[model samples]
Target chain A: MMPDHTIPPSNIASSAARTVFFVSDGTGITAETFGHSVLTQFELRFRQIRLPFIDSIDKAHDAARKINEAYTNDGKRPIVFSTLVKHDLSSIIRQSNGMHMDLIKTFVDPLEQELGVKSTHTIGRSHNVVDSEEYKNRIEAINFSLAHDDGQSHKSLSTADVILVGVSRSGKTPTSLYLAMQYGLKTANYPLIPEDFERGKLPSALPLFKSKIFGLSITAERLSEIRNERMPGSKYASIANCRYEVNEAELMMRREGIRWLSSTAKSIEEIATTILQEIKS
Target chain B: MMPDHTIPPSNIASSAARTVFFVSDGTGITAETFGHSVLTQFELRFRQIRLPFIDSIDKAHDAARKINEAYTNDGKRPIVFSTLVKHDLSSIIRQSNGMHMDLIKTFVDPLEQELGVKSTHTIGRSHNVVDSEEYKNRIEAINFSLAHDDGQSHKSLSTADVILVGVSRSGKTPTSLYLAMQYGLKTANYPLIPEDFERGKLPSALPLFKSKIFGLSITAERLSEIRNERMPGSKYASIANCRYEVNEAELMMRREGIRWLSSTAKSIEEIATTILQEIKS
Candidate 1:
């Protein structure tokens, strides 16, 4: 699988492309998610390839072959981020021609030492339904978030753990959903439409739950860019309208003593984390 | 902070409650998420406490105190699932009277051995936005999923990476949002309403992208229970109506040769993973 000719160092430097592999015996999501988190610290560009459900020796060999191919083709060692629970499978990937980081194997030994108990060393246990109650809470939170999204239903507003307030595209939906999915928080989001801005006050339905509202603020330029993608050339997508709405929303939130955070530079996880902190505090 | 009194062995055996800590310098999400996955393998029930943004020695000391409190209150050593990147802070947590599993410490040495390169050993690097393009993709995917949720907007259906079709309350919204959040996939979900079931076919807008269609099915019992939560004692929440809708939806999907999975026993992550696999194949 090795390439016949080596690319010039100048070409390699210019392209700045590296191959990255996420290998796992299960969904590979955990490995990929944390792996990306680590990889982001490096400035190099990467082409990611995920090989999930690599439960058997055959699958592991295939994965190793893929990693080796990437290494040979690129004339540089590929980086493999793996979460294989089985020692044999992990070892196979570790032996491949790549810089390997096996998440499960790396931590299991220390966990065993500290616990003074033999690790279960199980596979496919991380993502499975081991506890019915946790599963139920997750599903219930998802349902609650869906029901209360964009203020579609207020009949159960009292049940929400937190309600997110923002303009049409200040990123309320994704943040609400992230809170639900990650933390099992029953999140409800309300968009501050033009009518709400003109009214210059909180909605009638929100007065009772004023304390639960956490506002999201975004830059007008970013809002305009997002709105333009949804409805191009519309007055709603205009920067002027966006700026007006944002300023008014902030003013209203401040007057009502609702804490607000600008989401222009924050990721959904960061935004959700901030909201979780706000609600908890 | 050791417990002054011995908890009765009988009570401990019967209740089986333990305290679990997910400590990290960043969001603590990686620790909490994969820690839960690992903890679920054990039958024992845990009260989880998260300590995030522990980037300082002072915060680490506070975290140790909290862990010690859990140990004393529970009359059992707590389980510490940590992802501390800094050595000094990790050491402080290690000194606490809990079974500590430090993720970064466990993996970094081996990674250094394999790569022959020193890790950044940096705090707050994992979750920060180091790659703007990846961040943009995630935000874009989030926007796409929200816009197309429950067939709210079909204007850009063709742009969807995957289109999920399922009956109401069959767990489409959360699954779609999870796909977008985790995989950065442009997912659009459509509910199979009474009209679609009456027509006994896939939606008119779905055929052109037939290959992208994946269906979610749920048991009538579960569907009824879910619906009853939203609209109690109504026909929409009736078991008979749920059975009819689910059956018709499955039939329509089968007739259209669309692959489907039952979401009754699956989490949103599982459902999204299945859909991701379906689309990939």
Candidate 2:
């Protein structure tokens, strides 16, 4: 019941660190994401806990007890971000000595009223495996992305939804995987190496799939920092080498008429969204 | 402004299919997720569109126009799930002919009152690359995961946060990548083939990391179905072979006292969360 000491203290001296719980009947990913997004607007440190699969009444009681204990230990009300679907279970958590934010019910009631239809009130529906086809496509996309990473395979390049061309450490692999995992997009990432630059042409397999190809570029300084982490003091990680590679890659993309973006300041989500927008549009 | 005929009609005879917009100044991922979770409670069909990076006033006006157009085209008010931080932008969107669900503001107001603090009202904060160390760790974990997938290397087995063992098509690779991408966990997945079952022991390198190992099992029917998608008529897709492999894998996990789960009915999120709970606890 003790406060989690792992969380660093907040800047506010008058208030103790608040214990925040992401309680859900499902995997709790949505609740955690929603809570994290809202909490980022404030300048406070929170001791975070995730209590997933609180489906049964007994589990709900247990979660309520834990929330109450945190409140008692911290001498402040804990923040509970809940996505529980069942009315009884959510009511139990709401009774605890904490500020319970029923993230789902808060919007669901209004939606039900607006639509003039009652909700199903099903538990674990958000992350459930009801749509088997969608699930299979996601798994297939992940496998395809892994197989095609860094141009490891060229047999099925035509099947790719999008192909990414970039220099080493220009944020291609992570972006490719994100697109595959989140959107079930088959992505193949090929690194535009110095050999291709010397040849002054695209990779052999890339010319045919030019329309589906998108490019990613990074600033020389940022690319050097990333590469240096892998191979310190090597010519590959040198700033001059990075500058030349970036310049050549940009020129190549321009000549090939490939749309590109710099990933120096963008997160994987932003990069993936931009790519999806470009390709779909 | 015409109705998108690509979307099939809703089951309801009288009402038309609704249009849902996930509008945000950032990637709109959070808004889309939140809206999707809420909408799943209903049986009505919706054509969802994501409008990300609506940061500028001009873009906000354009998004408002799109929403209004959808309302006019569909003869039903479109549902707008907005996470806009700027007051003027949100107000403009709210003035449109749609039901605007200000997801962030609804919670932010109550949170500000409870904490007696004003929010920063920042844009693009959730998925922004503001925390460089955390971002670097995520990228590193991703690279480490890709390199170690399917037991591709034994060089850094000891560095893995958790290692997964399962038969082919038992859902290990996707789970490993999900753990790595979402939680920054370095996960290595190894397939338990007939060789391991015949030997009647864990993999040679796995025994060294026994404490960090977890197992996944699936029903024979499900395993056969999945494998059949890859190789239609091979022995690998036969129910008898799938049954034998799954039985042997379960026995191996039980004999070794390793914790495991049935992935037959679980989504990747559920499986990954369960594994994270098991390993972390």
Q: Judged by TM-score, which candidate is best? A: 2
The backbone clash count of each candidate, in order, is 0, 0
The number of the candidate with the highest DockQ is: 2
TM-score of each: 0.81, 0.95
Residues B81-174, model 2: lDDT tens digits: 9999888899999999998899777888899888778877889764345345556667777888888889788778888888999999998989
Question: What's the chain B TM-score of candidate 2?
Answer: 0.93
Give the per-residue lDDT digits (tens) of candidate 1, residues B202-242. Answer: 77888999888899999999899889988999999899999
Q: Cα miss at A1, model 1 (Å)?
A: 28
lDDT string for model 2 (A1-281, tens) is 11122233224534567889999999999898888778877778788989999999999999999999999999889889999999999999999999989987788998888887887788976334534455666788899999999999997988898899999999999999998888888899999999999999999988999989999999999899889989999999999999999999999999999999998889998999998888768
Clashing pairs in 1: none
What level of docking quality does candidate 1 show?
acceptable
Off by more than 4 A, model 1: A1-19, A55-79, A86-100, A116-122, A125-131, A193-200, A219-244, B1-18, B56-61, B64-78, B86-99, B116-131, B193-200, B219-251
Question: Candidate 2: misplaced stretches above 4 Å?
Answer: A1-15, A126-130, B1-15, B126-131
In angstroms, give how far residue B229 of model 2 lies from its true place: 0.6
Please, what are the lDDT tens digits per residue for candidate 1 over residues A142-188?
A: 77887788889887788787888989889898788888777777888
